[model samples]
Target: MNAKKGNTKLVLLTVAILVLGSVFWVYASFSLLGPKDLGVEYTHEDYVNALEKTGIQIEYEGMTGEELEEYKLNAEKKSIHDYNFEFSDYEQKQFTLTAAESTALLNEIAPGFWWFDDLQVKVLPDGTMEGSSTADIKRLKEDLYSDVADDVPLPLPDSLNIYSKGRVSVVNNQLSGDPENFYLGAVQLPDKYLEEESVNTMEDYFPRIYTVVPGLEITSLTSNSNGEFVFDGVIPQKVSVTKK
Candidate 1:
């Protein structure tokens, strides 16, 4: 090759390396920034409000992370429901529940105005849970376990990382706890479906229930740039209401 051509190629290579390095730095820095941007700003009051708004109270049963396994199995067996769950190492906490207890708890804790479709309610022994309607499962899974195609030029960190958004399944009954970190609940408007008012009620109600669930926290709630509301957060344990 000519000297001039070789020089041109070397300059291009240096530019490419700098560009790639800059991109990586930006992604790493901002990967955890989504929660802050969404305005979740969790506090003690937000937690208290969550339960009151839902007309429910979180009565602690004093369970721990180790106890959660039994409660999980009991819920599966009693409900005649098959489920697969995963949790993050950091997220484990105590909870107490049975299948019947779980269902009752779910009914009690959830807001009356909001109807979850494929409700896969997983309550740990420590009182933590992953509850959502069936309608939201597919998107939930994809968000939790992010995917990317090989060909994309501008690399983007999985926008749906555990810290970014919580998985929601409006249809199926699979709950995962893989990224089980604590966060307070902060419900915001749904981005895409704002025209539909029902979602608005949910946005307004989630924080109220957070109050009584001491072991629980609603970390963050957000919507897409397009305005689709995505709720993501954590509970310390499951809260159940039994037949007196």
Candidate 2:
């Protein structure tokens, strides 16, 4: 009886330790990342620096609604692949980013462009990218237009969800790059496409991300059980540029 009680105590203690560790992990990541200031908070210094580096120094004093959306998209186009701002791989090696870290990085990269109700992006084993996002239709419409009609919020669907599954790979930039330097290439798209005009628009409008670094090659892209995208070959330097 005493042994059983002791075992129970040990199990309880282990669980407690795990719970505390999980909490700390989340806390540390967020704290270390801080508020990367996107969307309405564009005036922040880090934001301004990123904009300046990319030649998008514009005022946001009185902008809102559609105007704000345009500014964000334009900024992303210019800065999505800029150094320090977007691609910060000093070591030219492929690395895996956690869901939280990647989310934070992307939010910083694109800022207020996505007025999403919910969203997620994950690279599974075999280089398959599984992505999902949702938006409140009414809210989106309102955000898109400076003036909204219908006094009572126009009745509409509660939310719209968009999903995408696709294979990804890297290839040497045919236009520019040797075997050593490469660009991220899409080897395949999922058999199941979202088929939503809005989703396609979202994918198209976002700036295309590509890399340009010497002596970086990616033979294969896969992930561990933890879903961390792994690179088979030497992880190239992440100095991506907005080619388009």
Candidate 3:
């Protein structure tokens, strides 16, 4: 009876230790990663910086409904515009122009300018300017191509008897790298056939990974006894995989 009781006590102690450790770990995790998860709030300065780096112009002053819409498109990084803003001086001046009108004027005024390619520009609601033009387009292109040139090999699908599969892991995303780089992935089949495939002839199928944990460097995967494939990776912050 004493031995049984001692064993029970030992098990209970072990369980208690584990529970306490889990609780402490949860608390520590919240303390460390909570701030990162909270999200980064971009300030006006950040908005300006991001826009200018992309070679957009700033027009912070009053604008017509059309001009404002264009600005919204640029500012939101969205092609769709669903709102309007009227210009205060539109009626008083002959230069009453919408965003589209202003763009036309600029285009006529600055045709073949190609200023956008290298400029870091922004336009605020009231027409404030904040941007730098240090973006090196040539260097940027070289870096992008170099990264994509490095490839990953995928085992061909078994049944089709496909010999080999090759792919390029996404090194940069729209939010970080050149937008053109990501856009290249969207080339249509017609356009693809028109242009020569530089890397691999296999139809460039986008890789669809099961997991999307940011900063996770996946190295391997395997199926467990439960019939679920477990992915293994080195997370930027080491996270332990424990059985429940």
Candidate 4:
């Protein structure tokens, strides 16, 4: 009887270990996999079209050595406020940006800005913006844990799937919105994790459209089932980027 009891206990322990291992494997697979494709793709042509629609110009020529250093130094000194937004010369105009165009524009303006790989954005029919990207864990660690002691071991995944949904609008001439949902891999972050300060920082990530074009206001920012965003606002004759 004693021998029979020992054999049964060992079998149960093995089964439990197998179950736990399977669970961990499932969790890790979901966390490491990226979000589903949105079925939209953008090309370099789309980026150029988006820039043209916005009336913005990027004047960058291949500069080598000293020329490149000078350009970087000058860019650092100038701010959005310094840009010439001659409102008086231009009238309000309406324009729309397709989901592809929007995504292309962002990639061009700031590639790897959020340390995301293959970042994409979709404007839902309900006017909410959804974004997905593969987070670069190394870059994230360097940015977030710069002050932490190097000796301390931080156990983090090599990469994570990130997704967020939010409604954004211009309030008092500033970007404003709180994300409705945020997911880090397969885990949905709780409301407590989305602090007010973090929301503010997210809002600040985008440039103030009004500041970019003086007297320009977003009259209506809505989306369609096809994932296109309509922008009813004034557009400048031309937006120039110069070192001055």
State every prediction's TM-score relative to the real structure. 0.27, 0.31, 0.18, 0.54
lDDT (tens digit, per residue) of candidate 2 on 132-237: 4454445445444324425324343434444445553343322111111111111122323233453344344321222223444545545566855554445323
**Off by more than 4 A, model 4:** 1-32, 59-94, 112-114, 136-159, 194-226, 232-244
Candidate number achieving the greatest TM-score relative to the actual structure: 4
Stretches off by above 4 angstroms in model 3 are 1-20, 23-42, 56-244
Q: What lDDT score goes with residue 208 in model 2? A: 26
Worst 10 residues of 4 by lDDT: 76-85
User: Cα RMSDs of all predictions?
Assistant: 16.1, 16.4, 23.4, 8.5
Off by over 4 Å in 1: 1-10, 22-36, 59-139, 142-238, 241-244
Q: How many residue pairs clash in each candidate?
A: 60, 3, 15, 2
| Colliding residue pairs in candidate 2 | 92-237, 93-235, 94-235
In the predicted model 4, the residue pairs found to clash are 92-234, 93-234
In candidate 3, residue 236 scores what lDDT? 28
lDDT on C-alpha atoms for all candidate structures: 0.34, 0.41, 0.29, 0.62
Better of 3 and 4 by TM-score: 4
What would the per-residue lDDT of candidate 3 be over residues 122-210, giving only the tens digit for each residue?
22233322222222223322322335433524321111100111112232311111111111111212334333453233223222111
TM-score of decoy 3: 0.18
Highest-scoring model, lDDT: 4
Worst 10 residues of 1 by lDDT: 76-85
Candidate 4: residue 68 Cα off by (Å):
15
Tell me model 3's lDDT, rounded to 2 decimals.
Answer: 0.29
